[model samples]
Target chain A: MLFSFLNKSVHLHGFFETDIYSDMQKPFYVKILLVATLLLGFNAFAQETDNSSAEENGSVKAEIKEFIAHHLLDSHDFTLYTIDEENNEHFGFPLPVILWDNGLKVFSSSKFDHGQAVAEVDGEHYALYHGKIVKTDAQGTINYDEEGHATNVKPLDFSITKNVVFIIVVSLLMIFMFSRMAKTYKGNMIPKGIGRALEPIILYIRDDIAIPNIGEKHYKKYMGYLLTVFFFIWIINLLGLSPLGVNVTNNIAVTFCLAMFTFFITAFTANKNYWKHIFWMPGVPVFMKIVLAPIELLGTLIKPFSLMIRLYANITAGHLILMSILGMMFIFKSWLGSSMSFVLASALSFLELLVAALQAYIFTMLSALYFGMAVEEPEDH
Target chain B: MEKLIEQFSFGLFFWQLLLLIILLVVLRKVAWKPILNAIDERESGIKNALEAAENAKKEMQNVTADSERLLQEARMERDSMIKEAREMKEKIVADAKELAQVEADNMISQAKTAIEGEKKAAVADIKNQVATLSLEIAEKVIKEKFSEEGKQLKLVEEMVSDIKLN
Candidate 1:
């Protein structure tokens, strides 16, 4: 019965592979190419299955799992993981993730099976592996081991999972850049070195962006936020160019956080003039203001939402297109077609890198604009 | 699954809020204030230097104008002194010429008077000599011609003189 099952699996794999290859030749070449590659990969595994014994198959699977676990969870490589020698274990635990509300959430290989090491402290449940706050759970519960050691159950940290390493790296880079700029200012020299490159961009944000939109009087209050947004977006966009497979800014939640910051700042800092224009709107008919009040309030909510969608959609689409093109290589199975696809994909990836920085700049610039509008004093006609 | 999403567990939110507050406070203290202060100081320094330069320029202009006025006054004083000296020299020269002419005229008049007095004296002396000679000659001739008639003529002359006196 086992033999028949293996044979059927092989037959199915071959059938799918053939279908994928045939599809590659169709008019929708790029799509066919991606499907074909995935199908062919399955077929190759099946072919290997025919020659290898069950024991060998089990060992191969074990090796693959071990490779993923060691690299992702144990902090073996520098790209995706950071090792803490003091803790003797990875810092954060990797949780099993299904889907996120805004995007796909998966456990980072950093903290695998670390749900076993959590502890409850003062009525609050915390994943306490090596004395750090690993994850916080909703309800307090202790899952005891066979030896009666208490294991803490907790909800996963979704923030770090999607692209924790990426976020960290980009944030450090931005802090470093801004810190250097501040130091240069203290030294009383026109910022030389890295400061030279960053100065014009900072000035552009202050002059062309913040002052024009926010008005001169209130622009100073929002300068800190505008600067933070500009650098944050720019740094994340730069990281997307690397081969580390980090796409933090592509997630809508990240964009939403940035937009919400702008919203809060504008709302809090708004003068009487801003609220007056929204509720009363000078020189307009009384009926018109009544009609416009709800619309204006709705617009305030929609502005941030639009900012979130625009950044998320552009970055996500760029990554998807690039990945799909790369997948085309295995699909075509023809050297000519695969080579052409690679060239096209590589060119597109380089273009996407430019787009990443551009998108970041656009998002930051737009948020500043919205802030400017919110706090803007009405013109004295 | 929907129930899980709906549950409001304050624990995670509290932690995040705490972290956000901490970040804001720390960043504001460590990074923002010092940087803004430095910029402000630099701007003020530049403004002060520019104002000082403008003040110095004004002072220099005022000094230049003052010196020019002083130089003009000095020049005018020197010109008036030169004019006064020239007029005094002309007056002294004219007085000296008039005194010399008066002395020359006085000497000429004195010499002329002395010469006229001497001529008059000399002519008077000649006339006296001529009268003496003529008287002597007439006495000699009278003595020779009529020694005997002299007593009678003397008497007749005395008689005529007496008649004439009467």
Candidate 2:
């Protein structure tokens, strides 16, 4: 009878263990792992298929060409692969839109797309395909709508991208908050309410970032840029967390634009002292100075380039790693393994959030430091 | 080369340039200006508030000093008034004592003069009475002696001579 009881208990334990495993399978981590494993399985399947297709064609190059033709630029179903959707259309081609008096009047993508749309109010010729507002007589000039109504001015066929919208909203929010803070200061009020919360951060930037990096006299000169950068990068990084998938910082082009702006500002704002330090070292040996000139000048250019690449690579790598981890879930056939992969991926995703903000702060801080360096006076020593 | 040149037209670049210019202009006018102005205004406000606080502190100090000065003056005035009262009482008491002394002196002098006049009158009366008595005595003795002594005529003549000499 004792032996039978022990056997019964062992059976019950087995059942309980199976139940626990089944319950654990439905967690978010499990889902992520499952999705990742599936993706990997699909990738393997595709690779096998590609090999078979290549064998049939007698060339791997032919298989690759076929794959590109079918996947990349195909116009079937009137669809385009775009990173962002705008104006109810995908951004497949580089296009320009005319914005005048805060009104979008015309948009155009490529010639094959919607070629142009004439303004219904005044019959003004608007090239919707290229986002250009044109007068009938002038090549690029815009003619006003005949109707006095402003809303009739339709946005060019193109719509604002998610990234652009995010940027604009964040910029407006920053402006509003800072303006309110200014009012609080004017009223001689202690930083109460939202102002109180932001006051410490602003002070930190001034005391910790601007003062230490830029030096006292020239810090004020770069304050505008520094504040702008800090807010801009922070806002973009935050938006990256949203479901909208705004990867502005990850986009090399966007980083390039930001880096370029900093470069131009530094280049234009550099005092003679900045250049003197680079081109001619006062205390260095003559031979060394000659050798250092080219390197120092090159460093100046490389500084901004590295800033761009650093921001882009870090953000892109974070996203890619997250996606890859998630993809591993589908690649694994075992439910346990997939679940574990998902848990790891989720943890990494949480870490990515912190990294995003940290990256923005680092970028802004470094940029401010560079600006400070560019404008700093040579030390007396 | 010609086809590639045709493909890559200047128009697209021109459009990009125009967009960039517009972006810069719009951003400068709308975004940068307001942001910078807000920052400047905030700084000025903070500075002004600090100055106002300093002014208020100085004003408070002045008011405290004024109150202290007024209190000191009041204390000094109270001390002086007390001193003046004490001095007045002393002077009045001195005057009263002096007037009493003068009245006593006048009464004493009047009594002494009356006493002197009365003594003089009494002395004159006493002298007159003494003279009368002496005369009476002399007359009686002469009458008695003359009746008894005819033989004493010569002595009477000598006595008359002595009386005239006395």
How well does candidate 2 reproduce the true complex, by DockQ?
0.01
Model 2 misplaced regions, further than 4 Å: A1-207, A219-221, A332-343, A379-381, B1-28, B118-166
Residue pairs clashing in model 1 are A37-A331, A72-A109, A73-A109, A93-A111, A94-A111, A94-A112
Against the reference, the lDDT scores of all candidates come to: 0.59, 0.59
Report the C-alpha lDDT of model 1 over A100-126, residue by residue, as the tens digit.
323344433333334343334344444
lDDT of 2 by residue, A197-294 (tens): 76666667777888888788877766666666666676677666665455556644456667777788888988888898789967899998998788
Please write out the lDDT profile of model 2 over residues B1-166, one tens digit for every residue: 2211222212323332333344445444554445446555777889999999999999999999999999999999999999999999999999999998999899999889989999998998998888888788887877766776674787878878789753
> What DockQ class does candidate 1 belong to?
incorrect
TM-score of 1: 0.59
Give TM-scores of the second chain, every candidate. 0.52, 0.53
